[model samples]
Target: MSPRIPLIFNSRSWNWAVFAVLSCSLFSGCALLPRPRGLARFPKGTPATKAKLEQVKPGMTVAQVEAIFGSPGHTSKGSSHDNPPFLSWTNEDLTAAIIMFENGRVTQRMNAGGLK
Candidate 1:
């Protein structure tokens, strides 16, 4: 019977192998990571805040409001729903920066949000 040879990795080769595995694991960890709850979409333009919400007064035209808050995420009233296109801008789910209009002017501005 012939003697069998056993494979053994030297210390330097073992270190390189460990380093490669760790590097791959680090990169894969980043890719598999979950996005944060509110930061996923990462809003563009001005973020919805109490100050910005207060700035949006009733009677401001949609154009003026757009100038301030940028495009609305979603509006409660449309042209069909509201002749003047009463606007609503919700930054996140179940929350809204409410801007109301009547008589071709801003009627009410309200902030609606369930999140704390």
Candidate 2:
């Protein structure tokens, strides 16, 4: 009986094998690739929410609230003029707040509850 032997490859096959290995490596834990860059990210939650919320008072314009908390992440109707029906903001930490407005002023602010 004849014994089986491992098959050998030519130059082309070796190049393809090396290419396949390098290609896969380029994506995973690869030192050869450059680090990805992006805009600086900030947390979404209202830190010192109590203080900030206190700053917001009924009859303060949307702009006034924005000055304290920055622009809201979202709004109920997406209306620039008639907002405060409900303005909601989310933070990177997932801490959120929903401000209720009446007569174009902040009436109340509530923590947009997070996971239990």
Candidate 3:
């Protein structure tokens, strides 16, 4: 009886192996990676300081919040069901400033790491 050749030695199998490797490398580059979500090291706008964050009120408008915290480092567009549009700010110290907006007004505010 003749022995069967290994599957990897077949041309079809070899092509699939090369395709898989190229696919992985193509998608793994930094160009396809999401940007780092953090505060700008040197902010060109208003800084997210403890004092500024304190001024954010639940009823404030988006413009009002922006006035206090400046442009957010990250802005997430939320859905209507459970999520709402939100803004985020961060600092070099890893302190995070987040604000949720509903109907274009502030609905929630969260601070983690306690900005100083």
Give the TM-score comparing model 1 with the true structure, all chains together: 0.49
Clash count for candidate 1 is: 3
Q: lDDT scores for all predictions?
A: 0.58, 0.55, 0.63
Question: What would the per-residue lDDT of candidate 3 be over residues 8-97, giving only the tens digit for each residue?
Answer: 766765854674454345434423555667744435544467787789999898778777776755343556533457766765444667
Q: Model 1: how far is 44 from its true place, Å? A: 5.9
Candidates, ranked, TM-score = 3, 1, 2
Query: Which sequence of candidate numbers ranks them by lDDT, best first?
Result: 3, 1, 2
Mark the 10 consecutive residues where model 2 has the least summed lDDT: 39-48
Candidate 3 weakest ten by summed lDDT? 22-31
**lDDT assessment of candidate 1:** 0.58
| lDDT score, candidate 1, position 77 | 66
Tell me the lDDT of model 2 at 40: 26
Cα shift from native, residue 24, model 1 (Å) = 46
In candidate 2, which residue pairs clash?
43-92, 44-91, 44-92, 45-91
User: Pairs clashing in candidate 1?
Assistant: 58-106, 59-105, 59-106
